[model samples]
Target: MSKILIIEDEAAIRRVLVKILNEENGDYIVEEAEDGLSGIEKLKKDDYDLVLCDIKMPKMDGVEVLEAVKKIKPEIPFVMISGHGDLETAVNTMKMGAYDYISKPPDLNRLLNTVRNALDKKELVQENKRLKKKVSKHFEMIGESESINLVKEMIEKVATTDARVLITGPNGTGKELVAHWLHQKSDRSKKPMIEVNCAAIPSELIESELFGHVKGAFTSAVKDRAGKFEAANGGTIFLDEIGDMSLSAQAKVLRALQENKISRVGSDKDIKVDVRVIAATNKDLQKEIEKGKFREDLYHRLAVILIKVPALNDRREDIPLLIKHFAAKVASEQGTIEKEFTDNAIKLLQEYDWTGNIRELRNVVERLIILGNKEVSEADVKLFASK
Candidate 1:
């Protein structure tokens, strides 16, 4: 059911508005306020999906009410009610965040359409917020060690800038998490963040994968397709395992970085792109450069802000917190009560070599949760958490 509030000074107009809405939809619960002040009081005390506010009222006008409501509950959609003289003011209210406006003696079709559209928009905004929260949880950095804290500080400092970041770390050490945090906290958070794993794509196709290709570019190219760089326009693109990218692809990437433009695989037309590049690799690019496997110039371009993630053994102090977090997450996913890890069990797990880092730790925790008793113990770690 949708909750709507009508703030109209005229009793007859208020009744007619309520009657029209109630007759239009049985699910609408319409509430009335005699003036703008009373409407604001109600808004403060209760939640309403939509507000139909009059432009002129005693004590407070619709513009004032709209401003106050925006400061308080900015998400609620407002549809201003205007008289003949207030048409200009009604349009102005839209610039001030009103969803829309309806003239006095409202048209049935226009009023209903605006109300439905506003509600749909509200629903979309809420869904986006929920999905963003879920994505944040999935990539949450779950440690407080000094090494982790330094990484967090760096993210805060660099996220607002359009700098290219190169993250170096061992596999499974959460380099991808750092990339996600940078994009989510940046000015381009509203735009898409495209990711490409250089090591995963075949060397023969890596160029086309990053720079797109026109139709008939290759034997298998049936249609034109946008590449990672094109898809990430006005946003961030995460290039993982960039050390494994072929030399030819590196040249194209360097050109894109230098010129902010790319030509498709089979086309000569250059396309402009505004993108923030965040690249990560487990292999040491300096060593690759020495061996002639990686370009020296490309390395310099990508490493404007370098962040090295510490190995798990170096941040062992955060293992206990990580265990608790994984335990709750696994239980939630499996629809079971979260089992506790005894102090000794946590200590034992922390002492082991985390060759695979956080990724390995999560797997071990899941195994223990499934095979161990309700409260996992040191013995359980010994029995099931072995390499």
Candidate 2:
């Protein structure tokens, strides 16, 4: 059931609102207050999903009540009840964060529709918040090692800004995880974080993929499309394996970074974009630049903040923690209890060279969990974890 609060000074109007709402929907539990002051008092005591506040009231006005409620419970949708003379006030209240407004002696359809829409919006916002929390947990940084802690510190300082970040690391060192953390912790967290693997796309189509194509731009382009940069407007665009991007695409990317704009493949018209660029590469970009495979200027632009992810072997102390984390995650996914790793097993695994870094470690843990005894032993590591 939806909880609604109605605040009106006039007894007759309040009764009418309560009656209409009660009749409109049996699921709506409506409460009333004689004026704004009393309404605020009730709001402090109860959690409401929506508030229908009258513009002209005794002791306190709707505008003041709306402002106060915004500070305390801004999520509660507010619909202002406006008299003919108070229509302007109602509209102004919306600018100050009211969900919407209803003119005096509310129209039945308009009131009902507005209330329903507001409730729907509230639900959507709540769902998005829940999903964000879940995503954050899934991508959690799971080590307390000094190297990992330094990376976390950098993220905390720079995630709030729009500065571009260039993350460099060996393959499978969780470069993508760092990128996700930066975007999720930033102000643009609510917006989409679009990822493009530059190496995954063909050289000839890389430009088209990064900067969408208009219809008939190319033989394969049957419809107009928005590119990653355009799609990531008001959010972030993560360019993974950027060292593999063609020099031509690199120039376009540099232009986008410099001017905050991009042109589609088939069109010359520059489309403006507002995006935070976070790029990662497994290769040494300086060497690539020296070899003429990458642009030096573009490197400088993207490296406003540089984060180097340590290889798994370099932080072997974190291996035990990582194994436990991955074991729990894999077990949860497979609907089984997590298997414990014997101290000897963890030490034996840590001594091996992690050429594939954390990615390789996770695979080994999953294999051990599936093949080893309830408590994984050093012998289990030798049999199943051949790396």
Clashes of 2: 0
What residue runs in model 1 are displaced by over 4 Å at the alpha carbon?
1-135
Backbone clash tally (model 1):
0
Best by lDDT: 1
Cα-based lDDT at residue 145, candidate 1? 98
Q: Which stretches of candidate 2 lie over 4 Å from their true place?
A: 1-135
Quantify all predictions' global Cα lDDT against the true fold: 0.95, 0.92
